[model samples]
Target: MKIKKAFPPKIHNPETVNFNEPPAKLLERLYSSHMPRSYKKVVNGKEFFSKLDPNIAYQKCPKLKELLDKMLNLAKKSQSTAT
Candidate 1:
């Protein structure tokens, strides 16, 4: 019988700094621009909180929420115009 070798799973340290990671401002912009609110028929309350990064999500930041709302509204308007 041939013996098979087992390899340990790769583990990544969450605390380790990753230079490849996008900056917080960019992340915030991306997150806000892409968050689904109108199409998903959801409000920017608890559901939004659940979908955001826990570390910065609970800060109750209004700018990010405003950006998201703006993006969602624009998408909805364009969608309506298309149809």
Candidate 2:
């Protein structure tokens, strides 16, 4: 006798992401994503940390705004699905 292979459950609506968390937390997670580069520089015996500005990122990467919008939508959707 051959045993059947088990498969993961299929998602009903793949377009809508369900993070199972609050909108604030979801937005924080999206912001923490590696969209901007962070750098550390030491000058005149002083260390400074610089991060890519959102405006610059938007200008440099056209898809940046689109991605951010998608994440924002996901965060909003998560708010409704949050446990």
Q: Pick the candidate with the highest TM-score.
A: 2
Residue 72 in candidate 2, Cα distance off native in Å: 1.0
Question: Candidate 1, 3: how far from true, in Å?
Answer: 39
Each prediction's RMSD over C-alphas, in Å, is: 17.7, 19.5
Runs with alpha carbons beyond 4 Å of true place in candidate 2:
1-49
Model 1 CA RMSD to the hidden true structure, in angstroms: 17.7
The residue ranges of model 1 lying beyond 4 angstroms of the native Cα positions read 1-59
* Candidate 1 lDDT, 1-83, residue by residue in tens: 01011111432443334576533433344445554433232443445446658445323545666777799899999999999
On residues 1-83, what C-alpha lDDT tens digit does candidate 2 reach at each position?
01011212443433444678543344344434532532222431132114325675555554677898899999999998996
Q: The CA-based lDDT of model 2 is what?
A: 0.46
Candidate number with greatest lDDT: 1
* TM-score of candidate 1 to 2 decimals: 0.32
The Cα local distance difference test for each model comes to 0.47, 0.46
